[model samples]
Target: MKNFRMRVWWFLCVLPLLSACGGTEVTLGEDEDVAGMKGVVERIPAPYGAGCGIEIPVEASYLPDPGVCGNGICEDGEDMYSCMDCAVCGDGCCAGGERSWNCALDCGSVCGDHFCNGGETAATCRADCAPKLGSVLLQRVRSCRNRFPLPCNSTQTRSEFHWWDDFNVAQDKQKRTYLAQPFNPGRDGVRHLVFIIAGQQDGDMASGLTGQRDGFKDAFRDNDGSMWVGVDGQSLAYRLMAEVYRSPDDTFMGLAFDARFNYGFTPSNKQEIENAYYEWLKEKFYASNLRSIYLAGHSRGGCLAARLGRRFKQDFPQVPLILHIFDGVCHVNDHEFGTNGSGYLNPLMNMNGDWRAYSTNVGAQFPTTQNLAVYNMLSGDQVLGDFADYFVSVHAFSHASPSAVTPSFTEGDWYRQEWFTWTHNGMAHNTVSDALWHYQLSCNRFGC
Candidate 1:
């Protein structure tokens, strides 16, 4: 019995050890199954910890499911968690149940789209809308017009007007510049031509021809042949004369001379220069058909025009002529406050045609004379005012006699002295442009 007791005690002690060893063997198989089922279980942690620890083998199949879309969430099936339905996956339609704010990838905010969305403005997206008037005009001046056409007979025809071609460009005297335009040979009636002299600047003709005044030039070229006035923006005028006058063979002429050569004092050679210009005009157009001539000049060119006008009146006494001068007057002295000379005064008196002069109110510098229609535009700025005051004081001593003074002269019919808030440059450069715009608008309604 004692021995039986001893054996039972021994068995009792070893029983826990045997049971632990058996548990170890079973755990090994379970761990192996857990590791092998990791991928199938979607790497989800077991509900009881360490993934099905000591649980039944069937429980391994019931491990928590992982997020199919990799969003770190547990869901029912692959379909619900699939990225195919997500709005961020670059689908054209933002219809994945997502708003633009939430999913910008699908609904981009860009310009040039048909819709004016994404903070797009008319300026930014002009392709989708129209701009304002000021912007439109600004843009028009910025772009250059190439091969501008003459509007005629309901048809468009392109032509080039070389405003500087008539000047002595080449040293070779044989190379003479000629004026020609498409004319209706059968048309009949007298036509008018206008000449516009540019200011004292090199390449002013080229600038006038190809720059800001291109549209203005086009207006002249496109006008109907009946009483059409050809405006030459620079010296050396040429145009295709239309025979729309009473005499079918008669041709009217307008010439704008580049007074580049008459820069400084040319008292002795002034007459010779004037004669050359007259000869050019006579050679180009029949002097008999020239019923009227309109001569215009800007700056020093105006002084030259005034001198030339005196000569023109003497040469073509029958041809009624008009002088349009801008900020130009001859002075005995080249100094700013010099006394006015006969070169400028004689033309004012002798020119049998209308006289219109546009200038800034620089006191004595601006010629104020009888028979001279002067538009003395005041800038109204303190700087110009002070300058004018100084100019008047310098020449105040020279005007002791009423005849020698500008204010004493008889005011022409169109004499106007007005004040404007514009700049000096604006008043000087844009006067002709403004006048041309008004004249063209009127010409469209009434024959020029």
Candidate 2:
């Protein structure tokens, strides 16, 4: 009871700052002197409209015939020498007949490059090719555990983490969406939970760093680049992880939907993925009587979260839902402008022109792809639709919903820089989400 009183006092004290704060004054981290990182980020011309996060296969050829060995994706037992699409030239390996002349870049010297290459056997180059300490992904994951620790606050007890809709596991073992133990009701006796759907290839809420990956597909995806579980995530737990846990006892769960089924293309895969989330709503989120629910995501995941927010509100009218969108832009073929996403990532790079609007039909002078339909099918998709109790779209890549909070390029210089940095790295997303989560906390506690 004493702890509860202290929490109430803390909430009251924090509410005023949240209600009055704006981007200029919102301090995102313990230290905001990230100018060195920020300076390098701002100068790098950011790549626009990369279809959430999943990098499409080179030339959209991987999915058309994945059964065969020579198809674009390097299948099981296939390597550079065995497949035309696979290339070990830059992988620091001189296998498959690559030598000083044809592959001089790597074969110049295979003795100390950490990979036993060319004709150097394990016996000859034991030091260089010694068996690494652990699995490749494990090592990368270790290296990737950045400043972001699981952000569950010290006051809350977050449940054990086993990523759901298991994108990294065997297919038979995928799509399980329950905690090992049921969530603990807070001091308030509320089973409030936060859920986030990661953008295309972007999955793994606990993958502490950007390049941390789960599989071969991560070659293109900066897994944790959304900054969902970092700095702001640490102090404001109920936003991005069970790690997404809050001090007042609310917690969050993230669905790292690889959307691999989508690629066959990321955009085409979203239809199925979104449908799966609807099931998650029934089977997981709405598992019991929920007091309040928070929904958010980046890119395609953000678009899906907006749509899911509408569904949750409709199904449980008594429950309050808060929806936040982070630069969501979806490009699928369902609508007129929705092009086949199988090639979405490839064609954009080779385009000779800039799209006035987001479209696979690049260079179109006025392609009408910037409709709410592109993101997801939201019922409240008018000029000012109400999808949740509170809806905020920090639209930089593009708008997530056609809701009451109309998005514009004029959201201030703050919004532009946030998304721009979000494009190359997740610094901006971290800051924006940090600021917004605090504001959300204040609002949930005191109706700020």
Best TM-score among the predictions, by candidate number? 2
Per-model CA lDDT versus the true structure: 0.33, 0.34
Clash number for every model? 12, 5
Candidate 1 overall lDDT versus native: 0.33
Clash pairs (backbone) in predicted model 2: 54-201, 237-244, 241-244, 262-265, 262-269
Q: Write the per-residue lDDT of candidate 2 for residues 1-448, one digit (tens) a residue.
A: 6544433432333323223211112222343223222211111011112221334332221111123433346666655433333545656543333444345455454465555555654456654443321211111110122333543111101221222232232222222121111233442344565554444453443321121233423332222222211122232222332222332334323333333222124443444445555654454444354556666555555556655665665566555555555544443434322333232111222331121123232212122212111111111111112353135211223322222122222221111111222331242134444535433453455331
Off by over 4 Å in 2: 1-190, 202-252, 255-269, 285-288, 336-421, 424-429, 432-442, 445-448
Q: How far is candidate 1 from the true structure (C-alpha RMSD, Å)?
A: 27.6
* CA displacement after TM-score superposition, residue 126 of candidate 2 (Å): 51
* TM-score of every model versus the real structure: 0.34, 0.35
Model 1: lowest-lDDT 10 consecutive positions = 133-142
